[model samples]
Target: MPTPTKTGKRTSGLPAKTRLQWSGLSLAIALFLFPIILPISGLDGPQSRMLGIFLAAICLWVTEAIPLTATAVGVIFLEVVLISDAAIVPVGADATSAKVYFASLANPVLILFLGGFMIADGAAKYGLDKNLAALLLRPFGGSARLTLLGLMSITALLSAFMSNTATTAAMFAVVSPILKALPTRRARAGVALAIPVAANLGGIATPVGSPPNAIAIGALAEKQIYLTFAGWIALSLPIVLVLLLFSWGVLSTVALPVGTQLELEMKVDFDRSRAAIWFYLITALTIALWLTESLHGVASTIVGFFPVVAFLATQVMDGEDLKKISWPVLWLVAGGIALGVGVGATELDKWLLGSINWQSFSVLWLLLLLALVAVGMSNVISNSASANLLVPLTLGLGASISVDQGTVAVVIAIACSLAMCLPISTPPNAIAYATGTITNRAMLLMGLVVGILGIILLAFVMPFYWYGVGLLPVN
Candidate 1:
């Protein structure tokens, strides 16, 4: 018989993960009960209850004791039971209707994201993503530095439309041959690092580019500040381009030798089938409509449903494709929306802001604080969750301080996407780390520099630019 061997790492006791879950869950529960069991000084009953929900949400989202979506839905459920009109213990007759909480699932922003998801998934299903990558990279030539630039540019462009995680995965597949042909592991690591960094930066360019953007938009809509698709691109695309080029420079200096050559090859085949043709047309038209929202005056959310109708009507994307959409992301965004509604309706923001002296805090310093907090939290938690927690608070601050609601929301959203310090920072980073081509130390080094640069740009440089361009409230 084989001898039983003893491993030093927790062979008999509860697993580490299970223990973490229980601890996190316990902390969340205690937070939820704190506001209710011991009332605060100035907050009323509804405000106190909503405060508990918000606190608990922060704990649950940061710890991820439950799935992110589960925590999201749990927030909505708690709002309905504790603060809404359907509350088991009524606060007052002014409680919001339960339907208001439920409406978050079908919020207009989620509809817009649904449309984006369909187009992105359809691109993957029809091979448009890879073909586009191949077509676009042809212009960059065969030098290692130029090839790196091309790879990042294409990845960023794709990520602007598709999800960042999906964009990173697709781009990696397209560039795997190049990665393998590199003579040094440093070159390979540099090439690999570019994809995720670019994807993370690219996600700030448009409203549907990532979950944080959508969350920011949804929160802004509640405050009567709307941003069109084209408007968002106009606001953020410059930042994306600058960051992309900066990251490329960092990677090139660190990884590629002065005169290295790279061989590049890609095969592009367009689908000419009837369904594919219709999908292609619909995709183009939908994008055109989104970009021209200023001219047509149709809300982006209304235009968002165009593809849903066109694709299904033309049989371009069937039921299976519909089922494959990133529903969890949509639900997560919805939860954020619901949380915003509950907080606003219950006057929780007013209570939270009441304690702070906004008269002494300059708008620049306040914006700086929000951006820094967003970057730090996002590096350790989900970007969307960080944005979900921060955007609404920033919106509330607009009324109390001399800040532009739209500018602050956009700042927090962009900062959330800027975090990429670890394997767990974002899905794109995790994907790159999983490939075994890049080490954690390398990612930390690169991600830290990029994140700090981004924060500096956001706090000092971008605000001045926005002010010059009339994007911010001129003092």
Candidate 2:
């Protein structure tokens, strides 16, 4: 480490981290200019340039060359500067190109996440998360397998409605006391691994569960295909449940002697304040509204504001509390939305889908293709970014394939969540890794086994599940 001089300023040339950032940034810029400098076949004009921008954005996002939100901001800048024809001359408010690029800022999908963050923040504020976890889990007692599964199940339940990272962080806090009370490393690893693993699995169960699921829903709705909140959960819950059980088994092997009885006092005493009670009521109300959206003809976006307003009113969260919400995440989601919009506006989505030759492909082949593309990319890139990059492409195929967009969307989003092999794959994985408890080799072995099972299972079950749900045709 460089030390400060007497003048209180360190004299350093450049750090390795800074150099890496510069290198990644330089490579991203080069990739951005690649299409413009040397035009490709079939990508001759604006599409080529825009494709360059997309690829560069994807590169920077995956590499962490700069802040992901800043990369998104850069994308907006490029879109307006290079492609915003409406900005050159006003088109009399008929939805300008510049406006299209930035439309995601006001996207309802993002609003849903905003409300979720507020609820999560409020839950943390009043210790409701710990109390809820303790009450639900205390029944398991000392039965090790049940305890392990119970921990994962509760973690998953919370993740089904909130951010997985937040859920995992909160769950880990609840479990740290348990981990210390456990005698063996094996016992600790079992519960420790379960937290993040469960978070990833639960995240795919609903639109509000994860950014990728939300991305799938938003992209599908753009094509006139929509799913009620319950509709999405019904389609995905089976997958989450099965994967959770399978992961528990895999983790049990690594966590040998998992049968070892645990004796931690799972009871947590947190008296419910009025703020906490209001938080629960508002959160429940918001979820109910989302589930019954089709019945009442209420869009989830309109219902999303319920918690945001109610939380502040009850003093569960004040105005300053809004700043605690993850603004970068909002920016990141907005960027994905903007990218999806650009892909459609430039007809690039159509062109890519048109090239797929859907008639020549069977459903199995298409499913495999999507799984490979999504899972392979997600292992290296963040799952949200993976979904953002691919969901738009998949959405474009609904017309060409004559298939139900809802079915395809569910399968693809789940596939993205199967990327659990690396620490950098997701926020939950990173959190688990930072604990210094589980080794990378352990994560790699266990995660790959679970990930492969998830992919194979998703491929087989999705067609039958959707057909039964009446979303896909029974061919």
Candidate 3:
């Protein structure tokens, strides 16, 4: 019913596109609908329905196929309105309990953890993060590899207690200046890419390092399998160290030939000695608190509060800068937590378990499939959402295959953080991409290489170590 425009062009009520683009869209649409047409050959009921919703959500997320927040709301609406029948309900009548549905939003631990992000934001605004980076990189000004190590180490250390996005943003601010000082374009590009890659890689070191870790930990605890700080470290640290080394090797081998090293021009105006002492003391105390949680019977959330209070009281950051925090991210995480809890509380997990044909697949094979699916899904969706959707599925798969459910669940959790392939893949990648130092092609190539390496490392090494350390029971 559309009319022609003033120029005599037809208005089909569709966005303008070239013929080739239209052809591609047509092909994509066909491919998308292929599964739906062949009903008998398609996925089982719960899985088919869930996959349809998940794919739709992912398409919207990846292509801006729609507004992101709107898509998230759409997911909730679809689940509540379209899929709320007895067959599709997650917790059944109990799942709809106001207490469980809104639990994540009201969770005290989650709120306290959200406050940590505000502290990090405050640190970034006041230039404290820059000061810290400068102090760390000053000694390594003459050596490229040492500079890389310093940056990686500092990022890893910071990520242990702060969000990876906050750490990447903070480190990017400091590293950008150093990159500009470099004489060669190649060196600038290489360091720019490496900084974010390091930040993302470092995030696997701690439970608080990324949302996926937090969700996995929380989900497991819901099942009554509590992971202690020491237990998490035992399972994760080796994976972190090995992956760090692998990443270093890859980046080092692909080094850009340096033409000239820049003179260290930045002056240290901040009291490095005092800041270093306070930072270390606070860091040590925080770690101690996490490690001794079983003895104190105190939650990590309660322990995390002390550092924020100390950081504020010591004038490390002003109260006003705290407003810069990503309140939306906090909300997003809370929403995800609530959604995940709802899924578990309902019969959704059990339904998924009942529907899968696990007798046809081996445990190792299933785990590999999950790893690949997770990495691919994360590339399109938020890593948190990817983990949230996949964790229940993985847990369900594990039970069907007779594998240790906790181990399989944790593996998927850690693997979800392995999104390194694109700008939108993870926040650290976005921050790095924003610098304009590296090309999208270069970032993708590097991320592809590193991502594969990470998967191989996690797939083989993590399970063995987890079982050996007693964090996971032998199956």
What's each prediction's clash count?
0, 0, 3
For residues 1-475, write the lDDT of model 1, one tens digit per residue. 2333375343444335677777888999999999989989988888888999999999999988888999999999999999988999967998999999999999999999999999999999998998889889887767899999999989998899889988998898888888899999999999999999999998889888999999999998988888889988988988888999999999999999888998777888888899989989999999999999999999899889999989999999999999999999999999999999998998888888878898798777777788889999999999989988988766878778777888888899999999999999999999999999999999999989998888888887788887888765535
- Name model 3 segments beyond 4 Å from true: 1-96, 257-266, 271-284, 306-322
Clash pairs (backbone) in predicted model 2: none
Which residue pairs clash within candidate 1?
Answer: none
Model 3 TM-score (2 dp): 0.78
Ten contiguous residues with the weakest lDDT in model 1:
7-16
Model 2, range 303-393, lDDT digits (tens) per residue?
8877888787778789788988988887777777777777776766777777657989877767777887888899988787888778876
Q: Worst lDDT window (10 residues) for model 2? A: 87-96
Question: Model 1 — TM-score against the truth?
Answer: 0.95
Candidate 1 vs 2: which has more TM-score: 1
The deviation in Å at residue 38 for candidate 3 is 17
The best candidate in terms of TM-score: 1
Q: What overall lDDT, based on C-alpha atoms, would model 3 receive against the true structure?
A: 0.66
* Model 3 poorest 10 in a row by lDDT: 86-95
For every candidate in turn, the CA RMSD to the true structure comes to 4.3, 3.4, 6.7
